[model samples]
Target chain A: MSSELLFAVVGALIFTLGVAGTVLVANLLRRILAFNLMGSGAFLVLVGLAQRGGESDPVPHAMVLTGIVVAVAATALALALLRKQHEMKDSEEELTEIDDG
Target chain B: MSATLAFDLLLSTALVWSAWRTITANRLDQAVVMFIVFGLLMTLAWCRLRAPDIALAEAAIGAGLTGALLLDALGALRKGKTARRRQ
Candidate 1:
């Protein structure tokens, strides 16, 4: 098979695995990791498609670059939210313990 | 098979394996490390695919930045858990 085709197939499989992980994993952090995996898979497919013609296409490359930046920003925001949630939960638990005591 | 093709096969195998391990690892730390490895392998895949721009972004942003973020989050979670246990 052509390299493009090979990469495309692997990319699809990766994307599928990412989707499964996102859906099945219970932990919020794991779900975030899975979502990133899904994004990478999608980027790979786009790159693979960019290689279809004789010359490489620049449009997909530009798009993937933008995607990478956006993904990182999103991940940072998600992690911050998770940390906030954890802090709230911990404080709530402490309050409950004090009340019971 | 040509050497390049052989390399591609190996890289793809590693990518899938690491991705799977990242998803299924019991500990969040293990999963984060595996995900970082997966990201690095993805950079290699991008290189083989002749997308140097992506390879660079994947290395710097995907693996480096993301790994740091995950590790930081994991640290916070661990500290909270330990504090709760102590209390």
Candidate 2:
């Protein structure tokens, strides 16, 4: 099989796996990781398609770079939110403990 | 198969395995490590796909930045869990 076809098939499988992980995993961090995986898989498929012609296309490469940046920013935001949520929970638990004492 | 095709197949298998492990790992730390490995393998895959720009981005952003973020988040999570246990 051609390299492009191979990449497309693997990319689809990776995408599917990522989707399942995102839906099924309980941990917030794991879910975020899975989401990134999904994004990468999609990028791979796009790059694969871009290779169909005799010469490699530049559009998909540029798009994937933009996507990588966006993905990193989103991940940073998600992690910050998670940290904030955990801090809130810890404080709440401490307050309850003090009230009980 | 030729050497390049053989290498591609190997990289693809590694990618799938790492992704599976990352998702299913029992510990968050293990999962994060697997994800980093997966990201690096993806960088290789991008190179094979003739997308060097993506390969560079995958290395710097996908693996480096993302791994740092995940590790930092994991640290915060562990601290919280430990504090709860102590109390």
Query: What TM-score goes with each of the models?
Result: 0.96, 0.96
DockQ of each: 0.81, 0.84
C-alpha root-mean-square deviation, each candidate: 1.1, 1.2
Where is model 1 more than 4 Å wrong at Cα?
none
lDDT of 1 at B55: 90
lDDT of 2 by residue, A1-101 (tens): 77777887788888999999999999888999999889888988888877855367899899989999999999999999999989998999999999999
Candidate 1, CAPRI quality class derived from DockQ = high
Q: Candidate 2 chain B: minimum summed lDDT over ten consecutive residues — where?
A: B1-10
Q: Can you tell me which runs of candidate 2 are displaced by over 4 Å?
A: none
Residue B31 of model 1 has an lDDT of 96
How well is each residue in B12-68 modelled by candidate 1, as lDDT tens digits? Answer: 888889988989999889999999999899889888878899899989999999999
